[model samples]
Target: MVEDEFATEPFEVAWAGEARWFLQFLSEGAGEVSVRTQVSADGLVWVDHESPALSGPMRGVMTVPVSDFGHWLRLVVTPSSGDPSSLARVYLALKE
Candidate 1:
């Protein structure tokens, strides 16, 4: 189960036409998980995107779209409430 917060590797997305993040929880035992779409100018300082934060059940997948996010992108994951994530994965998709 995930106890601490999670952050994905910084991605430079200057050429990508579209970007989306998929977050999944492997088990139903864990509570809800939340994800924030963040952007950075230098890959260090990050701020939330205009998109709404993602939060939902622990057994399904939640997706967040990103746009106007400058050149750098990443995801920050955390437990929405209750128990932490039993098993979780975050995937980023970029369109050409």
Candidate 2:
């Protein structure tokens, strides 16, 4: 799920078996878009994605596939150039 507004961080997930996590997001007002993700076996320790997962001009729904099925996960939007209310408009998808 989205963790914050205009900025999402420390997204979390818990997979029962085989599952996939997807996030759909958008940016407004003409600015670069960027995404970051962090994974963890336990919620306490985190391993951030080496590079920004998503970036560039604002566009339609941007779908991001998270890591392989695991016990816990967290996805975050590292940066943006929009209002929190606007950034809050992110969508998440999952398959189990």
Candidate 3:
């Protein structure tokens, strides 16, 4: 799900008040990109992570653990390309 092409597709996760690691698929050569995992208490206000869960060129699978259940979770990617579609080449998935 491509969000803005220039920015990145953002996803929200709702946990049932349990600690779990949120996993997703990632691709390489998408361009200079970074992945940010943020947590929200009420799904309204969000607190950005101190650092990106994943950064630099993607190599393989990237994993981000949720220390605690959050009302909301979001992931973002930064594209090097000026065109949005070009940045939308990469894909992320929730594996079974």
Give RMSD to native, each candidate: 1.4, 4.5, 5.5
Q: Can you give the TM-score per candidate against the true fold? A: 0.88, 0.58, 0.48
lDDT digits (tens) for residues 1-96 of candidate 3: 323523323445453443333223343344444556666677666677554456544334445544443456555554434332222233333321
lDDT order of candidates, best first? 1, 2, 3
Residue 18 C-alpha lDDT in model 1: 93
Q: In candidate 2, what are the lDDT values of residues 1-96, reduced to their tens digit?
A: 232323333445563433333434443434445665666766777776554577644545555665463556555654456432233355445556
Off by over 4 Å in 3: 1-30, 50-52, 80-96
Compared with the true structure, model 1 gives a TM-score of 0.88
Selected candidate, larger lDDT, 1 vs 2: 1
Off by over 4 Å in 2: 1-12, 16-27, 50-52, 80-85
Q: Number of backbone collisions per candidate, in order?
A: 0, 1, 0
Tell me, by lDDT, which candidate is best.
1
What tens digits encode model 1's per-residue C-alpha lDDT throughout 1-96? 556677888999988889999877776745677788889889989888889887776777888988888899999887777777477677889987
User: Where's the lowest-lDDT run of ten residues in candidate 2?
Assistant: 1-10
Model 3 vs. true fold: TM: 0.48
Please tell me which model should have the higher TM-score, number 1 or number 3: 1
